[model samples]
Target: RGGPTACEFSFVLETLGSKIAAHEGEYADSDCYEILSELALLGRYELRALKLELRLAIEGVRADKFELPYRIASERTGCGFLILPVTREFHDRAFNALQSLSLASKHELELERQVGIGMWKNSEFVDVEWIFLEGGNPPDPDLEGRLAFSYPFRRVSEQRLPPIFT
Candidate 1:
């Protein structure tokens, strides 16, 4: 199959937004509860903008024009789970963005630690992991591995001074 389409990406984001919305009231007493609620609201607007950006980015471009840093699993975890492998950078950027949205440092740190450990899991590949969240259909797996091992790496050769021994 081919890489994940923009529609699939949008669907995944929407599913995540829905799950976040559903849990908005679960931890009302937590310090980061407000931030979680705010994120759910902001996610809707951001997801739309992201879809537009993705559409523009892929417009008139060939399938192989750009490579994704991680893969999408072809099968769902059960029925409503979509497993998405994403780079650590992507994960960090998302949380960092949330932090920049007027969240207190303590709250931000707590939220990151909680969500990172609770929601996300580490995969076998380096700098990549699967996001197994509820909702959305399974997308076709990308034909690559994690970013660190996606491409071949060349080792540098050491130069020797042969004349000095003679």
Candidate 2:
């Protein structure tokens, strides 16, 4: 009779499987790397919840410097030490997509303004950060008639875009 602990493991594995299947490209269909990633994350938290061991926190936030409540939370459920920092690798495809969006600034060479999205992977003692930049600036993080042109970075599954991170 493995109560809630076992049930939690079952649920986590199920979610891990689904999330794996959700990843697009050769990585999902052939490599299956996403599932392995999920397991690594879940295993971190599971150790904390079940074994009452040390743990860490994974956070994604928009560095707009004003709005606060819109941060993104990435979590794991076991082991707790290995903090995997996963994010959308904005190589070339990301920039081309941002270029198609409407711009709202004087710098004709730029998209919107600059909006920066970031992820922080923190464990009991370690922290790794990743940043994704779009647009360039929005005049300000506290204004109405404006959009940080480069925002809405095509929506990567585990991404939290700036000016509207989640």
Clashes of 2: 15
For model 1, the superposed segments whose C-alpha errors exceed 4 Å read 1-6, 24-49, 52-86, 89-94, 101-166
lDDT of 2 at 79: 13
Which pairs clash in model 1? none
**Could you give me the TM-score of model 1 versus the true structure?**
0.23
Give lDDT per model, in order: 0.29, 0.29
Question: Which residues of candidate 2, in runs, are more than 4 Å off?
Answer: 22-166
Question: Model 1, 12-95: lDDT tens per residue?
Answer: 445445656666887433433432443343333343443443343333122213222111111111111111222334444533
- Write down the TM-score of every candidate: 0.23, 0.22
In terms of lDDT, the poorest run of 10 residues in model 1 is 71-80
Per-candidate clashes, comma-separated:
0, 15
Per-residue C-alpha lDDT of model 2 across residues 105-139, encoded as one tens digit per residue: 21222332221112222223222221222334444
